[model samples]
Target: MDFVPLWAVVIDYILGVVMWTLIGRFGMGLFLPENTSFFFMRFFVQATDPLIRLFRPITPGFLDARFVPLFVAWFFYMARFYLMPWLLGYSVMGMLSFPLEGEIARGLANILYKFQN
Candidate 1:
């Protein structure tokens, strides 16, 4: 269904927030040994760096650089909570009614309505 992709995006955003929160609360040291260049860390760094870079400039430096991840998480949550539903609603309205479209739209509308509370 059309809303499936939008739901996936919402899930990804939630995962991103959780990932950032954990990393921000506990620095990489807890997860990786010092001086260890594990493949997972490399992968995580690659996945998160662009987002950190985007937010770094706007973030206040009252705390350590660790806050970057939390800021990114908050940004993702805001986008998910405020922007995603509206975008999905517009997208659904634009599409032709396939057999599954009504069901998908109803599901998405329900999700958005629930989140609004």
Candidate 2:
């Protein structure tokens, strides 16, 4: 199998994680009240709030502010699922085409091994 370069592997991993966080934050909003004191929920809110705020002003007047998470999630979804892969010279086949967790782990292991040797 062809090895993915370390930079691509790292970037893909980070993008996937951030995109997943945005999705989770959006999903949590659907059921939990935003003011809930749960720890993970609070962390998710704190983490994604800036992105939501960035998109807030462009939000349509008819759409409620609570829905901003969904829009921010969509933005990260597009960046992770489409833009990153395209920039990396891969066809846009969604997450399946991105680097796997194991691949990133292996790449990091290889880099560390080389540095030590």
**Local distance difference test scores for all models:** 0.58, 0.73
Total clashing pairs for each candidate: 0, 0
Judged by whole-model lDDT over C-alpha atoms, candidate 1 comes out at 0.58
| Candidate with best lDDT | 2
lDDT of 1 by residue, 31-106 (tens): 6643457766665566677767777788788855645666667666555454555555654442322223345678
Query: What's the distance in Å from true for residue 50, model 1?
Result: 2.0
> In model 1, how large is the Cα lDDT of residue 13?
49
lDDT minimum window of 10 residues, candidate 2: 92-101
Candidate 1 colliding pairs: none
Q: Runs in model 2 with CA error above 4 Å? A: 91-96, 100-117
Where is model 1 more than 4 Å wrong at Cα?
Answer: 1-30, 33-35, 89-117
TM-score of model number 1: 0.49
Q: What lDDT tens digits, residue by residue, belong to model 2 across residues 34-116?
A: 78998878988999888777787777778765677776666766776677666667665463355655566789999999999
Candidate 2: residue pairs that collide: none
Candidate 1, run of 10 with poorest lDDT: 92-101
